[model samples]
Structures are given as structure tokens and as C-alpha cells.
Target: MSRLDITHERASYQAVFALDVITAAGALIFLGLASKPTFQRIKQRRFTAPNSKNNSARDGPLKTTLGTYLFLWPALLCLFIAYVCRLVSDLLKTAGTINYDDDLGWNGRRAYSTADSGYASNISALTFTTALATIFFTVLLNGGVWIHSSHVQENGTGISTPRTKSRIWNSAIMLAMLGTGLAAWGLGIHARDVSTGSSGPHALLSWSTVLQHHRATRIMYIVHEAIVVAASLSVSIEVLREYATTNRNARDSPERKDLLRFAFAVVPLIWLRDIFILYDVVLLYVDTAGWSATAVDATTLLLVVCRQLANLAILGMVLWGAWRMSRSVALFGRSYYA
Candidate 1:
């Protein structure tokens, strides 16, 4: 809105991507080690149970770990969203049908979205894909993790009934996700019609409806993040329960040491990532600051900085997870812990 030196934005993106490459490469190597025949044999032999004292027989062989599947689905979904976003921007640029100052008006409020500019089709498609991907990703990824981790905790600690029913929590999660997706698509349709200079039944969503969409999306994201944190806490409690009961003095065991490391390391990092991301999302909408250029610039700068910091923290978390996996491979060639 304040017409920032686009160069700064470009530089930040480049720097974050460079760090991501390193993180991705490190992760690939860690995953590669996991794929070795020797390690696979060892991993299958190790980590074959519910790590509880009461249920020694609950342990059995799993051909593959849950984390592997959980990570892959979300990654693919995010990649799809990013590709759609890029495609929308590239199509807009290539068509050269609208400039920021004219067609978009001041601060990117599209005063005129012409069909000739590809606003209706391309942007609508991108927005719909983004809505779908984010909704499905959050529901499947976090929901799945919470479910599996809860199962582990329940079986290990023998805590069958938590304070709340899983069904209620799951229903709330789905509702939040659905509301987010619907709001996004609704906002997108509103924008598309606005650009084409038509006031359909959808035009009931005035430009301010966009702000409402932003607010709804933000609130839903916070709720989802909190839900994930609660689920993660459940996992930690399960681990601690084991330590208190069976593995009270088994810190010498690599497996026991690994579990403790995970409770402290990965969980806190996950907490940090979620908090920073939530704050960044809030800062992003601060562009709606309206007339004050200084406020707009300040908010934008903070948003960018916070996002990069969050990205850095995410990479660090993944790198740490990879290192932990490597440690498991070294200590027990067939073990999979990450």
C-alpha cells in the first residue's frame, strides 16, 4: 500500500528460500539414511511397541512409521497452493492488462477488475485452490497427528477417556476448517465479480466483506493452532507418563533418551512456529490500516520480518528433527524416530 521498495521484498524472499534449500537438502539426507536396507531392518526391529509397562503385548511390527505419511500429505498440499499462487501472479504479469496505480487503485484495492485482465478466471481459480488446500491440509495433517498420537498415549498410559470427547474436538476442527475455506471462496467470488463491473447476488459482499473474510480466517487459524497445541500436549503427557512409570531410571537407554528429547525439543519448536505464524498472519492484515502510510509500512515490515523469522524457526525445527533421526540411525541402525 505504501509503495515499498519492491527490492526489499524480493531480497527477503530470496534469503528465506536460500535457507529453505539448505533445510530441505539436510532433510533429504536424513530421509535417505532412513531408506537404507540396514537401517530399515534395524528400525523394524526397534520401536516395536506401545512403550508402556502394563501393555507389553501391545507392541507389534509396523511396516512404516506414521510421521512419514503425515509429512508427505501436507507438503504436497502446500506445494499445490504455492504453485497456484505463482500461476495467478504470472498470468497477471504476462497479460499486462492492469497496473497497480490504475486498475488496482491505491493500496491494491482493485477498483476495476476487467475480464480482459484475467481477474475473474485466474484469480478465482487460485483462490479456490488455496482455500481447498489449506482447509484439507489442516484437517488431515493436524487431525491425523492428533489422532495417532492420542492413540499412542491412550494405549500406553491407559487413559481411555480424556477430559473431552475426541468427537467434539474433531467436529470443531472440521467446522473451523470449513468456515475458513468457504469464506475464502466467497471473498474470491466477490473480487472476481467486482473486477468485471457486475453486481450479482454475490456483490452483497462489499469490499468490506474482504475485511470480514480476513477476520474470520484469522480467528479460525488461531483456534486450529490452539487445538494442535492441545493435541501435542497430549503426546507430551503420554511420554511423561511412560517416564514416570516404566522408564523412571532408563535415561541410559537410547530410546528413552530419544523420547525425552522429543518431548522438549520438537514440541517447543512446534509451539514457537505456531505462535510466530499466528502473529505474522495478524500483522499481514494490518495493511488494512487505511490512510496512514507510516502505519502501513511499519506493519508490512513487521509482517515480513516476523514471517522470515518464523520460516527460519521452522527450518531449524526440521533440521533438529533430521539430526535426531540421524542419531537414531547411528545408535540403532534400524530405528526410526523423526
Candidate 2:
């Protein structure tokens, strides 16, 4: 390759790498904030007492508190920033106007040629998909808050109720389903491009031209996502049941146990989703020669995998808390109510 070609390649590589780094850092920051004690306190405030007539015990500790908003706002801010940055990057790529190759070509060749097809259209679709997924996650987070608040109101001050446990289970299931669906849709779009020879945005539309090329693969991707969602939801339900039983007896219970067992049990299932995600990452990298080599497949699968892992860890923590609840409920039994 000529000097101009070398320079162009290096610039492209750098841009892709920068995007990856930013995405990873944003994800880690979000996860760290989510796991803080303030978040835990907010979640704990949802538990309700069984018999208190005043219902004051069931009222969330942070419902109107500034501290609660402080604890939650940072994560949302980080997510918003990350999403906006990603959208900007995608827009830049689709415009095909940024001259990635700065060095003058030996023969005045364009640094990167624009695709014959309208690049912006394909990118718009991808952006829309991502935005939709983000909305789903936001809804899930809000649902969690609602579920926690309801738990506090129903149980009174000292009594732990089973209904709260059910809500947690349902929330986890919904989140898992949403994540799984997004992953599957992404993979389906990826596979459709690979089957056709067209490059860039045009290749994405290739799916419309050849509907049967990779139909089986697309179906499999959808099924895998569904299974992941189902398994995660099942695990969440089990953990909630254990939590309700444990919390109800904590004061009178003598046996102190860790709920980590339930957490560990669900790890394998949650990890399965990550494993599939990794497979997609490897396949995309190998087939497309990394994001810079292909505009249509520029997304970083690793980032998505990391987010899934963080989610699994969060679920595990909930399980651990449930275990402690189980021990308390077992020891105290009827005395917890008294």
C-alpha cells in the first residue's frame, strides 16, 4: 500500500479504538455507581412492615429525599452521555464527509470512498434501534423503583411481605427479555450483512433483497435471546421467594446464611448470554476485520457483553440479600411478627 493508504488505515484504526475505550469506561462507571451503598439504601427502603396500621413503615425512606435523587441521577446521566456520544459517532460515519485520511495520496486518491447507497439511512435505522433499547432499559429501572416502593407500603414497618418478592421477580424477567431481544436483533442484522457481498450501508439493506440467505441463522439468534430472557427471569423469581421468607424471620432467626447460593446458581444461566455475545463479537471481528474495516458492523460487541455481566452481578447481590432475609425469617418465625 502507498503512504496515503497507510495513513488512512492508521487514522481509521485510531478512531475505532477511541470509541471502544470511551464506551468501556462509560459502562464501568455506570456499573460502579449502581452498586454503591446509596443505591442499596434506596432499594432497602422498599420493604414493608406486616401489621403496622399507620403504614408509615411501608413508606419509602427516600421517596422525597434529595439524597435518593442524588444516588440515582448520576447513573442516568452517564447513560445519557454515553448514548449521545455513540449516536454522534454513528452520524459522523454515515455522513462520509470526514476525511479520515489526512496525508495527501501519492496519486490523489480519496482517503475513503463513499458507498453508492445512502449511508445515512442505514445509520439512522441502527440509531433508532439503539434508542429503542435504551428506552426499554429506562422503563425497567423505573419499574424497579415502583416495585420497591410498593413493597414498603404493603408490609408495614417491621413485617416483610411476599408480594414485594413477586414484584422483584417480574421486574428482573422483563429486563432480561428486553436485553435478550436487542441482542438478537443486533445479531440478526449482522448475519444478514455477512451473507451478502455488499459492503457498508448497502449491505444492511441486502437483507431485504435476499430474505432466505441466512434465515435459519436469524431464527436461531432470536431463539437464543428468548431463552436467555426466560432463564434470567426464572432465576429472579426464585431469589425473590427466598428473600421474602428470610426477611420475615430475621429478628428471631439464629442461623445466619448467605444468599450467594441463589446468586451462584443463576450465574451460569446469565453467563450463557455473555458467552453467546462473545461468540458474536468474535465472529463479527473475524468476518469484518474489526469495526474500522466495515462501517455497517461498527458496533463493539464487547461493550454489550460487559453490560450484561454487570447486570448479572447486580442480580447476584440481590440474591445475597435474599439469603440473609431467609436466615432471619427462619430463626425468628412467628416472633418476627410479634
Candidate 3:
């Protein structure tokens, strides 16, 4: 390739690496959650639920609205379908066909070549669009949950106001997640594009569009990071504040303790994910020659693996919850409580 002719492989966030594996696993977990009747069955299984007293999960009536289900499941399905296309596109490509093969920055480490990489590029605009769609659906799914997370207390029980303070903030975290998703999508798209002159002078892509994508990625990166840090602090404070009351009578409840352990462990992983991602983002800006670029790649690989592990733990709980929840659904998908 010419000196100025730069080509890219798959985008980091959407690539079927350690991170997307984690995300794909979570898709089924989310699909189950979107099924209101099934989810309610899981969370409301008081018959077997231990020490129902003072449990935040046990208080509120289940959210079984059809509108919520509609918003969630379709978006979730889109996410899975998007990943499938991405993975298939990856599968079709040769291992490492970098446009700048001589450069150490993208030499042996990259996945596949861009559509503009050569005459036989594996990834097309279709894969690019699907990559974008996956993030969009992810944000949609989270937003649906954000709106509903506020129902911590039953309306008429009158013990305390719904933990609206924390719930609202949790929703805000979901909003941050949306921002991060969009940012990643933008970067991935721009990175996948064929260089302006590499394909043809006109080259289906415009400089302005690419620049816009880069700009969005930059702006959203900051927003996503800032909001994630804020949410972590907010969530930590909320959990600690309520720890005394939330777990006051919980010594007898092994189930509650297990759930808490899982949650506490997952928090650090989430932070780790953000840290590695921030490192990658920095590389995007000031990343330089030689071992530094390789180090950025290495650290990023570590980050994706760590994040996926966290997701596996968390989504395992969701799937487990779904399995348990399914038990509460009687014959014909009806709630056992009904």
C-alpha cells in the first residue's frame, strides 16, 4: 500500500472478540428479561425465596407491561442479529490482511481487512450498518430498564418512597451506557471505511462524514467515561447507605449473601472495563510508534477479556434468574401467583 493509503480491520467494540462474546452471551439473558411474564415469575418467587422480609426485590409488584416488553425484546433481537453478521463477516475474511502490513501498529495483531482494503474485502457496508444497529439496540434495551428501575417500592405500601433517587441515577447510568455505545459505533464505522483516495477519488465515503464520525467518537468518549465514573460513585453510595436496612435481617439468608457477593465482585470488573477502554481511547489520540502501540493493543485485549468475564458473571445471574423465574410461570406462561 502507498504511504498515505491507510486501511483498517474490524472495529474494536463491535468485533467478535472477548468483549462481544460477553455481550452476545448477555443477549439471551436480556431476551429473557424482556419477557415480562417470565421475568416476573423469576423475581416474585416468594414461595422459595428466602427471608422475604426487608428484601427490595420482593416488595414491588412486577412490571409486566406489554409496551416495555415490546421496546426491549425487538431491540435485544436486533443486537444479536447484528453481532451475527459481524461475526460472519469476520469469519469470511483472511486472518490478517492489513493495508499497512509493513507498519508495526497494525501488523500481526489485526483481525480482517476493510472493504476498501483490496479487491476482495470481506466486510461490507452491511456489516458496518449491523455493527451500528447492535449498539443502538443495546442502548434501547438499557433505556427500557432505566425507566422501570424506579419501582423499588410498591405504590400504596407506604413504607418509604420508591428509591427514586438511586433509581433515577441508575437510569442515568444507562443513559451513559447509551452514549458509550454510540461513541463506539461511530469510531468503528469510521475506522472501517476505505481511505479517501485508496478506493477511488470519490470513494462512496466523504471526508466530512468520516470527520463527523471521529468527532462524535471523541465527544462521546468523554461523556461516557465521565458518566460511568459518576454512576459508580452514585451506586456505591446508594448501596452503602441502604446496606444496613437492606441486609439488616439477612444473616439467615444465604441466597441474599450469594447475590451480594456476585454484585460486589462485578463492580470492580465494570471499572476495569472502563479503565482499559479509556486506555484504548487514549491510544486513539496520542498513541505512538514501536512497542507503545503494541502495548495499547495488548492492554486492550486484556480489557476486553476482563470485561467479558464480568459480563459472564453478571449475565449468568440474569440467565439463572430467568431459569428460576420460569419456575414461577405455571402452565401456558401464566404467573404462578396469578
Candidate 4:
């Protein structure tokens, strides 16, 4: 190749490589930040007692809020980093005059490269997935906050009322899940067209052709994402209801038991959906070995099958946990009410 060609290739390669490195670094930072407070809280056994009546008096306002916020710092950092990376990538593309057909210059040419295309698509999927995941995760975290706040308020004010705060939070979570699910469905339709025999680029190129192609794999991914979202929403709702009513008195008190049992039951379903997502990513991104083709696929079909079994195991564990919790709740109710 000529010197010009070599220079172009080198520059394009470097930009793509940098993008990947920065993205990975951001993810690691997020993971580290998220885990720090969790580790500390675990060591402290913060959940040992129900929210104390004098929590504010004992811990003070700043200490309580700071501790709670610290756990969420990592997630916030991840969101910030993701937004920055996306903005930077867009800027570079625009400045480099990157074109779908290499119109502008180095930036355009680099953006159109095969590696760049796959990278961009994968990042898009990951970003959307992470956004959806974060919504549900944050809601759960916030639900915990509401639980603590309700407990503290009741203690301080000498007012005890059935806590419907978590219910409101869970309802919001379900709505968010529904919105994300719809988005995922739309993306899935677009992906289906791309995987099939569509002549045009994916939706990033032209939104109109998004649903042109249809593929089973793409459909499967959309379904999987939807299932995970729904399952997560269900788990959150059940947990919230249980937390709200744990202090209530009932003849059988099956409500709390049922809620706990439902949560345990859904965990495996969520796990299964996660496995399918991993499989879909591997199949969609990685090259596979064939009679004449090179590059071995990193993920195996056997591994995917094993993931299904693993999901089943998770489900079994959840069911067992639910049973145990139910039995314990029943015994407690009988002893207390009898």
C-alpha cells in the first residue's frame, strides 16, 4: 500500500482503539465506585437492625445522607462517563468529517471501517441495555431509601401508617420498564431487518428502513430484553409490597410470604434472560469458524446451553428461598397472633 494509505489506516486504527480503551476504563471506574460502599456496608452489617427510631439523632443528618449517596456514586459516575464518551465520539466523527461513505476525511473513513461499524452497533446496544438496567437498579436502590425514610419519619413523628411509598416507587419502575421495553422492541425490529436481506444501513443511517429486515435471532434478542425488563419490574414490585406490609398483622399473613416467594421465583427467569443476551452479543459481534472462514467464535453453543441449565439452578434456589421465607413468616405470624 502507498504511504497515504498506510497513514490513513494507522490513524483510523488508533482512533477506534482509543475509543475502546476509554469505554473500558469508564466501565471499570464505575464498577470500582459501586463496590466500595457496598463492601463497607456489608462489613458493618448495616441491615442487622430495622431502621432505628433515633437514627437521625444517633447518626446525624449528614452522615446518613452521605452514606446513602456514596452507594449511588458509582452508578452516577457510569452515567456521566457514558454520556461523555458518546459526546466525544460524535464530536470526533463530525470534526473528522466522517461519512457513511467516507466523504469528509480521516474521521469519516474511520467511522465507515468494518471494525468501526461493529463497534458502534455493539456500543449502541450496550448503552441502551445499561440505561434500562440502571433505571431498574436505581429504582430498587431508591426504594431502599424510601423504606429507610419512611421508617425514620415514623419514628421521629410518632406516626405509624402502612407504607405505600414503595408501592408508588414500584409503579414508577414498572412504567419505566414498559418504556424501555418498547424501545428495545423497536430496536429489535430494526436489528431484524439488518440481519436479514436489507440493502440499506441500520437505523443510524436511515430510520425508515429499520423494520425492513426480519430475523429470528434479532427477534429473540428483543424478546429476551423485554422478558428481563418485565421480570425485574415484577421482582421490584413484589419486594416493595412485602417491605411495605412486613409490619402489618393478618390472620394468615400470606401476603408477605407470597411476595418473597414471587421475588425468589423471578430471579432465575431474569438470570436466563441475561444468559440469552450474552449469547446474542457473542453471536452478533464475533466471527465464527466455518469450512473456509477464519477467526474462531469465542462463545460456544454448549456454553449457551449450559447457561440455560445454570438459569434453571438459579430458579430452583429462588424457589427454595421463597419456601423457607414463607415457612418462617407463617410460624412467626402464628406465634405472634395466637
Which candidate gets the maximum TM-score versus the true structure?
3
TM-score of every model versus the real structure: 0.52, 0.32, 0.59, 0.33
Cα distance off (Å), candidate 1, residue 50? 12
Instruction: Put down candidate 3 lDDT per residue, 244-304, tens digits, no spaces.
Output: 3335543343324433543465445545655654554454444344555546466556655
Candidate number of the best lDDT: 3
For residues 1-338, write the lDDT of model 2, one tens digit per residue: 11112134345444544554555465555445444444544665643223333323343331222232332334344444445644454444443433333221111111232344345345435444543444354334334333332232223233433356655765565655566556545654566445243345443432222222355544544454445445444545554454455445442222113323433544444455545544443442243322353442234333343444454344334323332332223322332311
Between candidates 2 and 4, name the one with more favorable lDDT. 2
Ranking by TM-score: 3, 1, 4, 2
RMSD of 4: 17.9
Which lDDT tens digits does candidate 1 get at residues 71-167? Answer: 4334434534543453344344334232222211111232222223324355445544644555554445444334433433333334442237565
Candidate 1 at 5: error in angstroms?
A: 16
Model 3, residue 85: distance off in Å is 3.0
Task: Give the root-mean-square deviation of each candidate in angstroms.
Answer: 8.1, 16.5, 7.7, 17.9
Q: What is the lDDT of candidate 1?
A: 0.41
Assess the local accuracy of residue 218 in candidate 3 as a C-alpha lDDT between 0 and 100: 43
In candidate 4, which residue ranges exceed 4 Å CA deviation?
A: 1-35, 48-74, 77-81, 84-148, 151-155, 158-338
- Residue 1, candidate 3: alpha-carbon lDDT: 29
